[model samples]
Target: MKKIVTLLCLGILLVNCSNNDDEMDIENSTEIVVDETQEMGTDMYVGNFVSLAHPTSGVVSVSDDMSRLDFKNFKTDNGPKLLVYLTTDTDATEYVNLGDLKGIEGDYNYTIPDGTDIGKYKLVNIWCVDFSVSFGYAELKK
Candidate 1:
């Protein structure tokens, strides 16, 4: 009986160790792959904002598809009611309102309305609606 019990214990230990080895082999044989085919859109138009009624400075860019606007290192004076616009001229006479200005400082993004003519409207204007004044402007260029 003692001899039979000792043999059974050894057999169980060996089986457990063999299963561990199989698990380790599976882990080592597993493969990993990475794909790097896709790329981000490049800027189609870029301009520097110039202060008009208030102090403003930043870089504005439009993506290649003309679907979005990006503001980098943006800085401006705070106002009561400020708005952003894309216009044909600096005066903001004929324009499409993007939205309210996001902040007086830092980076921002505004979506351009689909089917809007970007080539015709080349100026990005920061205008105050409450006082009806232009805080700054940037002329987009290719």
Candidate 2:
């Protein structure tokens, strides 16, 4: 009976699973949005990355205009199917996919979708989409 119930629950979850892309109303543009400064923005909200499933270190900042995510001194272990996400929590519930990570180590930028409510997201996750795990995350703050 226990095994049957577990399988039933798993099946229900599978049926409800949907691709995150469909939930997002973002543009498909790949253009980098960082301004001439090429550095953190003046009125940015920032956070420091913490290792979770892998060794990760960096600083993540959201531009004051909420137009971009800037990763500075960012370092993380390379993994297959890694993605960047702005999530409501470290667990990635209620989030927006920024897209595939640009590199495993470097300063880079990811453009945020126009009209996204940046205030709703609390953490930036280095997520491994294939494995359903977070390699690291940064909790954002003013």
Candidate 3:
């Protein structure tokens, strides 16, 4: 009887499993919406890149929840490996590495680390790991 009950419970959980709709909704919101932003009280940290080693154009927006960092209209010359960062230093010497960038074109979001102190990180950098080069960077401000 114990074995049968255990199997039945596991089967029920598997049947109920579905795509996590809440997380999907946050990821899908790339463009900042006025009503949503007002309700959440999080104005997206918007910025644009200046030429460093590569020429790029785009807008990077971070949701006030810090759950999503979306890059829109983003373009950059291909490189070995690219990563995103929130940094206090322009050289990216002192920083928090967000995650591996999803792509160079189109819009995408990178998850911010839990308990990140957004106030300290004033710059966003797209860094090349293999070559230790900063392709471009943007400042985050109101």
Candidate 4:
């Protein structure tokens, strides 16, 4: 009887531990949003990434001088990837492998393809293996 009771207690402890681990994973994730219009100047708009909860949502407005890609609080993992979806009349889509962007804890800048159509786009989702486990949304304005 004592042995059986011990086994049952161990099982419960294991389950509780597993739950805690999952909570930690979520707590570590983050998301960031930046609004260029609110701030003056061009360079001021860059590197505005901030730490936030995992699985967050936000928007990014682009200006005439804004032709770069930037991100905030992006988690790093063994294999990170970024998927960009453009909402236009024809629905264009692109994918960028984020392997090089991993471990970048703060804001960073990236180059957008030249001649990207001027319109609003939604950042459908973002995912990483170790650093972040969340997704965000944004709109590009011209």
Candidate 5:
């Protein structure tokens, strides 16, 4: 019985170790290199992030004067290298790369660069830059 238990423990350890590597890779890759040099304002346009892989729900707000965008009460999978984008669609060539996401879960702010034409982009996308996957998105409306 002792030997059997020992073997089982070893087996579990190995399995856990293998899974950790993948998760670690994702964790490491998702860490955004932040500049942290801007001030964000109040909400202008807003929407909620509907889930793609996991359930995501929150208010995504673009500043009233178009100075910044924010994710409030946000939650989603901690994917590798998540990024923020302003685009017409998930796969659009013409897009504004907001920046690397501040985080996957919680309230965060992203400063919108000046002169970004808001006429065409209507979607805020949470994308995994490492995996080329969209974790979730928010659609802006009038």
Candidate 6:
């Protein structure tokens, strides 16, 4: 009887230990994926700049009064690099690259320089070199 009782206790202890190990393994295996889905139907503005789902009517004027291009549901391991461009009309396929705007984090702004030409412009694309992802055609009213 003593031997049987000892064996039963040992079995219970082993089962408990195995359960604990399994729980630890499950916890470690789980990972969270950020920026998996793009969130549409959101608009943001900084100073005179405005971003909508579709382009606005008339020429979207932009100037030094604008600060940063706002983004929704943007996630990254490090940060994103923005490429700003200017275009005259919608049918115009060619875009003039303004420059590369860096240091973009979540809900952050990129400063618009004083000499930036005031006209219809767009965010064009935001590149995340660290994550290897890019958001394209993010139109911005200058």
Best by lDDT: 1
Candidate 1 lDDT: 0.85
Give per-residue CA lDDT, model 4, range 25-127, as digits (tens).
Answer: 5454433334544443343222222222243333333334656665544442234453433333212334332224423244444555556554433332344
Lowest lDDT sum, 10 consecutive residues, model 1, at: 31-40
The sequence of per-residue lDDT tens digits that candidate 5 reaches over residues 59-90 is 78777888778787898877778788998886
Better candidate by lDDT, 1 or 5: 1
CA lDDT of each prediction against the hidden true structure:
0.85, 0.84, 0.75, 0.41, 0.74, 0.40
Worst lDDT 10-window in candidate 4: 44-53
Which residue runs of candidate 5 sit more than 4 Å off their true CA positions? 1-42
lDDT per residue for candidate 2 within 1-142, as digits (tens), equals 4566567767755644543554533453232333535445574688999999999999998887888899999999999999999998777877899999999998999999998777788789999988889999998888
Model 1: how far is 13 from its true place, Å? 51
Candidate 3 runs further than 4 Å off: 1-42
Q: What's model 4's overall lDDT?
A: 0.41
What is the full ranking by lDDT, best candidate first? 1, 2, 3, 5, 4, 6
**Clashing pairs in model 5?**
30-81, 43-64, 44-63, 44-64
* Candidate 1 TM-score versus the reference: 0.70
TM-score per prediction, in order, is 0.70, 0.70, 0.67, 0.36, 0.65, 0.30
Query: Model 6 Cα displacement at 103 (Å)?
Result: 7.6
Deviating ranges (above 4 Å) for candidate 4: 1-54, 57-64, 72-80, 83-104, 120-134
Candidate 2 Cα errors over 4 Å, as ranges: 1-39
Clashing pairs in model 1, backbone N/Cα/C closer than 3 A: none
lDDT of 1 at 66: 88
Candidate 6 residues 74-110, lDDT tens each? 3322344545444343332444554564433334334
